[model samples]
Target: MISKTTIDNVFDTARVEEVIGDFVQLKKSGSNFKGLSPFTDERTPSFMVSPVKQIWKDFSSGKGGNVVAFLMEHEHFTYPEAIKYLAKKYGIEIEETQQTDEQKKQANERESLYLVSEFAKEYFKHVLFKTEEGKAIGLSYFKERGFTEQTIKKFDLGFSPDSWDAFTNHAIKKRYKLDYLEKTGLTIVKDDTSTGTATKMFDRFKGRVMFPIRSMSGRTLGFGGRILTNDKKAAKYLNSPESDIYHKSKVLYGIYHAKQSIAKEDNCYLVEGYTDVIQFHQTGIENVVSSSGTALTPEQIRLVNRLTQNITVLFDGDAAGLRASLRGVDLILEQGMNVKICTFPEGEDPDSFSRKNSLEELKSYLEEKSQDFISFKASLLASEAKDDPIKKADTIRDMVVSISKIPDVIKQEVYIKECARIMDISEAVLFNTLAQLLQKEQRDASRKKRSEKKTMEVVASEKKPVEKVDAQYELERKIIELLLLYGPKEEDFEELILETDEKGEIDFKPETQTKTVFRKIYLDLQEDEIEFTNDAFKELYTAITDRFMREEDLKVDDFVKVLEPEKAHAVTDILMEEEKYSLHNWERKEIYVKEKKHSVSQIVSETILNLRRELINQKIKELSETIKQQGPDDEQVNLQDVVDYITLKKLLSEKLRRVV
Candidate 1:
């Protein structure tokens, strides 16, 4: 467990803007910094970071939190990992007690895989440059592919030695496990069929040039190896098999390297191969990633969704394989991404195109050739559909379906108009087609959910009952909000109790000026222990306690901008909710003083009622526990006493009933 002092230190030292600015390119916007949303695909900047508040909010995605939460979301760092990252960045020393071996061994599985893969990556790079065979073959291949020494190292380009156990031997010598090697598909195990005895395990990518595949955080997840020799039996390219850590659907090649650039440029240049990503990146187009020669998944598109909305897909102009490759464009649209297609001349892919041209020329050519999906599709299908009604109808349907995949209604409408202009079809016809498709898609999705619910019902019936949430929490939250927002107001009205100092006189003083009553009770409450039911409240309570400790003033407006937007808005809603009747200055007529509203009165009454109810409920719980401890034999209930307890309970319940 992290010490409270250390956690406070982490917050104190790590500026929210400084930490967030590392990942997001924030430009000054009033008292805050604004950037393109890191959690959504947006051309316009909607992500706001307030350094003064020490918080951030993504208006597009509605994710708002503190700096630590930002790192946890954007970098996918665990809380501890994010803390460590910030600590390193801010030069904070973390002093802590050591964990047990079992705790240490329970490292995050994703992190463990990354560590192993990183080791393998380094090992492969070592072999490529340090060893004799590696230097001759791997080095020569990369050099021939127009990769510089810097680029080779940048991509972790390497060679696997031809010897079967070369990598296995090195990994074992380094104390890595064979099970992990097999699990990650880095090594293959062989067994004798006759004797059922293990023969030997060897490297999976033997005699191949290695391209390390990485997750968004620049951690190596797996490897994609290319075979140099064109053997009839061996596959040309072999990828690490799907493992517990690497999901092909979610991982995009070069995302780790390109993420910042993509975010900075507000565009991602998506290609089709590992080499293409490397080549473009090497040529100074850092905002480039590949689909890794696999069909694009919605998950892959969503990975890009985090950084930017504009995706320019690069492909060859040749039509032979273009149709199949274009399938992903619709998926990109489904994610509300801005889809643009750019195709190179005959016999050229992005890899070849980039290599042949200077960085400036390549960049300019891409900008020039890039066309909207509607324009590109119209051009691609026009020749085939020339003068054929049935084929043209089919082509029009395909285009409409692709356009329908666009998530934004406004974008879809815009596309409909563009398609009508380009294809000479009525906008109404296309819009009608789109409506049908969307309805059908929604129906299919609903049916799938229904089927899933049936499966869940059977599974849930066999499981233990889930705990019911406490019903008083809402009331507790409301009371806490009132205390945090209005407690310190000097002239604000507050409930109080007054008693005459005579022998047997006690008086219930219903209401008084807030300052006197609150100052006394608030101080008293501070002397006693108080715990909030949730983290947000706990943080707020801590903030309040700090103020009280320092004899500092507290105000709703002072804390409003100090909290993250969601929390601030929550606080704001509570503080300002129906507190007073509206007054117009124009109609004031040198206005006489109007009596103050009963907002605080209602809040106080309800709070006191809820408090009494909570106290009674707590007493009941204690009595129940005591009865259980005493056992049924020892606790012989008195019917009359039970009736009296029930009567008081009903009175307390009646008070609570007035609150909700």
Candidate 2:
């Protein structure tokens, strides 16, 4: 368990914008920051972070909370894990009590998997530096690759022993569960009937050097291991199988280290392999990442997209590889990111090229050689299509198809003009082809939507009845929102007093009283014996009221940190509900909007009166039902009670200025 002091220190030191900015690109918007929703696939910014309140809200997903909550939501971290991450990020020393064996064993499955992966990383590093075989093999290989000790350590480069069950045996001795070991793909387990054992276990990456693949927050999700010796039957590289923590398509190697630099530079250098990223970083190019030898995935593209709108793909001299990578450019363009293509000399790749040049030389080469993706693609294909009319026509259509993938019409036009210039083709012809492709795409999308709608209609026939809005629940929610926003605020309220006028009609006389907002709300609810119908709202009401009563200084940020996750989520939702209106910039158009603070008293009184009326109506409904079901003796009493409740509701309604 992390000490409370450490957690508080972390919260105090960590800024919500700075923490979330590592995962999502945030641009300044007035007093807050807005960015594309990292939790959802969004084109426009819908994620808002308020520095003044120290809270964040994702209107797209409806997830909002403080810094700890963002990490828990985004990174799937536990409370302690989120705290530790913040403490580490801010360079705060953590104070934690050691957990007993039973406590450690009770951790959730995902956290256990993460723990195992982290343990494996540390174990592999110990093997690389401390063991003899590792020094002779894994250490030598990395050293020969022109990696310095610091670079190797910075990337957490390590080695697995050559023996099959070496790591498996050691992990078991350390009390690591074999289930997690097999699940993480660290140890391959199989039935062993001939050996007279239930199962056989062996290290998956045995005889290989280890490269820990990390999330953007630097959690060890898994590893990518490289086999050293020549084994014709074996693959050169092996990655951790998809598990609870590691999903290769959604991960990019070196992103944890490159994210800051990528955002700072406004560009990301994407390469093909792990070594390529390491070499670039070691060469003073910090804003670079790798695809880990897999084909580019949209998820991987979006990972970089969160940091920058530009990507420069580094390619080797292998023409086949370069051709294979062109499809990724279209993927990047589809995500609305600008892409540039750079290739090394005929005999070199990024790894080899960087090793052969100084930092200045590498920087100069990249700057001089990098070309806009369209120009590079056109030039390369034009050369291949030389003197072949059919190939040249196909190439032009191919470029048109790639251009059609771009989301921006202006960018599409720009690329089409550039393609025409490179291929010596007519701009009108390229535009016509693009238009046809786009039209077909739209038609296909429309057809899909119609088919989906038909299926949904069938499903809708059997769907559950729609839920009607609960007026009482809304009133309860409004009460909670008011308490969370203005709980500690003192204001004068016009309390409605019921009386019989001289003409024998019910009248509502306003009685003025000054009290704290929370006290006024609490007294009214207590007087009526009202309870929140919704469980979440009821819990939050108790928590907020208790805090307001007990603490003289009620800081929403500090108060929220102590609530349970569900209540904390509700508080942020209620507190930041009105912030959505600010996103429209209503004031920028010279239209002034009324501030809620100016009418807090009226809002509070109306809310309480509305609740009273709703509850009275509910009672009258019960009395009416009882009158129909009961004998004549009870009917008159129930009828009179209903009349009295109706009279009171009318007085409350008049106070609210609502028609009966």
Which candidate achieves the best lDDT against the true structure?
A: 2
Give lDDT tens digits, candidate 1, residues 288-358: 99878889998788777766768999887577878777789988887778999998998888888889899
- Tens digit of lDDT per residue, candidate 2, span 561-611? 777777888888988888887777789899888989988988998888888
RMSD of each candidate relative to the true structure: 7.5, 2.0
On the 0 to 100 scale, the lDDT of residue 60 in model 1 is 64
Off by over 4 Å in 2: 195-197, 511-515, 584-593, 658-660
lDDT of each: 0.75, 0.90
Error (Å) of candidate 1 at residue 145 is 0.8
Q: How many pairs in model 1 have backbone atoms within 3 A of each other, for residues 3 or more apart or on separate chains, i.e. clashes? A: 1
Q: Which ten residues in a row have the lowest lDDT in candidate 1?
A: 578-587
Cα shift from native, residue 624, model 1 (Å):
11
